[model samples]
Target: LIISSDSRIPSCGNSTLTGLDGDFVRRSKWTQLIPNTTEATAAAEAAGSSRAAGFMRLTSHRVTIQGANSATLQVNSGQMKMGMTYGFHLQVFNIYRGSNVGNSKETFLVSVKTEPVIAQIRGGDDRLLPIGSLTESKILIDASLSTDPANSTAKLNYNWLLSLSSGPTINTSSLQSLATEQMFFTTVPFLYLNKSSLISDSVYHLFLNVTSRRRGGKAVSSTSQVLRTTSTAVPVVSVLGGGIVNEAIPITLTLSTSSPSPTATYLWECTSQNLILTDPTTRSTSLDSQNLQILPSVLNGGATYTFQASVTIGGATGSASTTVIVNAGPVSGSCGGSPEVGEGLKTYFLLGCTGWSDQDTPMLFKFSTFSPTSTLELSSYSQLSSITTLLPARPSNTTIISSIQDSLGATSSFMFSLQVSQPDTFDVQDTRDLIKIRLTEGDSSLASVLISGTASYVFSNRSIQNTSQQASTVSGLVSLVDSLLNSSVSTTEAQVSTPLSLLQTVTSGPVSSLTTSTQGAVLSIVERTINSSLNSFSNAVASSTLGVLGNVL
Candidate 1:
């Protein structure tokens, strides 16, 4: 006997058998039992060939199972035998006649059941993503995905999202997607956000969704923990009231910023004429509470000072500076001479005195003289303040006074005295040489009587030669000689001979018998000698000579 069954039905179902007993008898079977040995042998051979082909098909193709959580299916390239002890009955048949009977016989018959093959899906493990600080408008989101060893053939797809607020809602308006090769399992996407579009002093959240999928398999998604974004603005610094300031005057300057960061810090600095101001409190150049006070001494008259302000916010810094100009006021100081000076000597009063503005101007001087009564005007065309002049020759002790005036109308006075002294001797030698006199007398013997003597004379008589108390009294002696000659010539001789002999000797004829010509000539000579002696005295004391000489005569 021979049995035949559908191979397709057994391949799609479970092929498990227990034993051949009453269970076999109760089970239904679709079989064609043949009585002819030749037909049975042919049917068994065909069934054996069909089963071989089905096994070959299972070995050549790969199988995939799709589900959220499913295991993988793999088939080996080899035949598997099915055995049963009681579930099915097998019949042996001889497909060939005579000698090849057992070689071509079909003997084995088995029932088996199988389930569908499944390909497992694995989503990578959950993780906390690392995020970098956002200093610019754009930032990079770099993340990686991994799977278990069982899902080695799975691929990962990443999607990055951002949310301004802490919630499930993500802003997709500016969402960006990244593409990579088929072998790549990591994504590095860039997220761009304008500073003007983001709220100030606010926190933001970032989410990373990773989906893993295999070929012909359903996708499984996994999300990362929230990541924070750090964004901050740079500080801007400005300086107020930075300009030109005068010396010794206090100037205030302020530094300000436009940053709202509580951690922001400010620094103020000042520089002038290549000098840096370090201590803002104790020094003339200093800063306090963002306010810089530049004292007058720091400005130093006419110098430029630079003020700088710097602000830092969240590790970002900015700075600004301004310049100040300082101007100075006018300043005032004097020049003079000693109390006594020599006559005919030059005296100088320093007009080059200080006490003027910083600007240059001319100086003027006025001089007054007591003796010879004169006034003089002197000027220094430039800033020089010294003046020089000659003290005039004065007959007596004289006083010279001068005053200096600046362009600013400031005045100062100076005075000095000039003294005149007489010579040691009242010498009339030069005056005597300047005068010549000739007397004419009768040719009898008066020529001998007309004695000629040198006009140069030293009147040693103390009575007429008093220099301290009075000048010489030679003029009064001349008048006395003339009076005596008119009244009594002999009496004139007696008074004249005493002082005259000390000056010059005059031998003449008898006074009563002397010719008119001889008398006139003698008298004229005597008068001229006295006049010349008195004129030799210093003019400083000469004015008192007439009175003294009158008392002596």
Candidate 2:
């Protein structure tokens, strides 16, 4: 009897079990046989019961088939044994009893490794920071949350894999030859990313493979179905959660960014003196500071109030303004727009509560609460206002909970579903027009530039030894010249060359065409090319991709 999903072993399709009295049938004399659901439904129908019985079925029979075939069962980490390998070994064949193994075909035996431990990654929501020069550029990935069911104290090696495409699934077959020690992590790992480096608004990824040290360091379990990073450039902010608030209904306005910068302090301010501001003080540091509770006690009809949010991240400081209408009425909400978005694409959502009436929700309106883990890359946000969210890379049906309340503490929340469509195979293009190199407002001294971003390593002896230890004066001078020539690249630039080729090999067409590299390199080139005309950079930032690099030009 094959209970497909819970079946421990592969089915052999042996017909003898159905005809002869097997141990299972003989033990119970087939007396307590669990009825097949179809027969039970028929009996119920004949008995005049109206219930359809639905998809649930009750059966004692087991299913047996040749080799490992998963019809609907998705094997997760919890079900498998610790050390045993579990996967289809179709080539191996032998006689078996009731789907139980009888013998092994040594010649056909192939090694299969399942996840040794449950790998889980936790930090917080999709970050509000992209890679830049600062302590906030990296985030700590907590693999300690990962569990090794057999031995908790065992030493596990971590290999953090970085990618631009967010699969959150295991697909190393497409990536190149696994690289060297640079990526292997240990204990808590910190991953850094630069979204500005990409030609488009591509999200970065960081996931680790938890390997057992005692088990030859083979990757048994990997952190999958999760994309934890985001590409929210700092200094950009949007306001949300407020529409028309009456004295009874309070409109809570929140300022949010794509990537929230921990170091960046934000100041949220309102210009309207008519409305009473709750906690009138400015918000600068914490998430709570980004939220403002306003009592539209003064608004009789509708008053348009302007709010400003300013942030200083790294060496960049920017401020944005938005306006909300305050009136005495009920809050209206609509799952804003673009009910569908391709996974991993960054989308801007309109304010959840639009005007005084219904129908003002946005992409932010379509949210899904995926369980067990936030592995699907759903950006965490409330449905109140304009928001920048990185759409999940994995295709899934999302549930967006949208609601709004006015000053009277009246709350209105409705849940809707958003469909995240499977991503199309990307058409690679060079979008340098979207890229701009605004050097952080800091010292860009030559030495500081070379020494800070990365480290340079050289043997001390290699530099002076060749000259001073040389046999003759001529050789020493020659060695000194040779050493100077060898020192062409700064200390940190030494390790930079290898990853270029490695990265290019693993990336896609335009990326493989050196577009990503060119994009980064050309930023400097473009900066230098247009150094005199700072306005060109602004013009480029304003450019749209109509198949011409007009902005770049």
> What would the per-residue lDDT of candidate 2 be over residues 1-553, giving only the tens digit for each residue?
1111111223459866545334331110011113444534444354343322321232333323322333222233223333342222122222244543333211111112333465655422232333332234233444455656455576666777766564234345422222322455665433333333322334446567876654434446875423323334445455555443444444576777654778877776555554444454322233337766654343344466656666677866545454455443344445443435433333333213344332221123223223122211122233334333433232346545454544333345555555543233321111111111111322112112112111100111112323222223222222222222233233211212211111121121121222333334423432333333322332222221111132122
TM-score of each: 0.21, 0.21
Query: Over the stretch 1-553, how does candidate 1's per-residue lDDT look in tens digits?
Result: 1122111111224444222122222112222223234544554456577654332222212122122121111122122211211011123222222322222222333222221212111111111111222334433333332332224354545555555564334344432222122112434222334433444443455555555543335444544333333233345455666443445456777777655456767776653435456745435433435676755455555565666676677777656565665554335444344334442322322222333333212345544443332222222223334444433234466555555544434344566655522223332433222221211221211111111111111222312323322212233223333333333222222223222321222221112322344345444645543464333343322322332232222
**All-Cα superposition RMSD per candidate:** 61.7, 32.0
Compared with the true structure, model 1 gives a TM-score of 0.21
Give, for candidate 2, the lowest lDDT window spanning 10 residues.
Answer: 452-461
Please list the residue runs of candidate 1 whose C-alpha ends up more than 4 Å from where it truly belongs after superposition.
1-232, 260-262, 271-273, 280-288, 331-355, 359-553
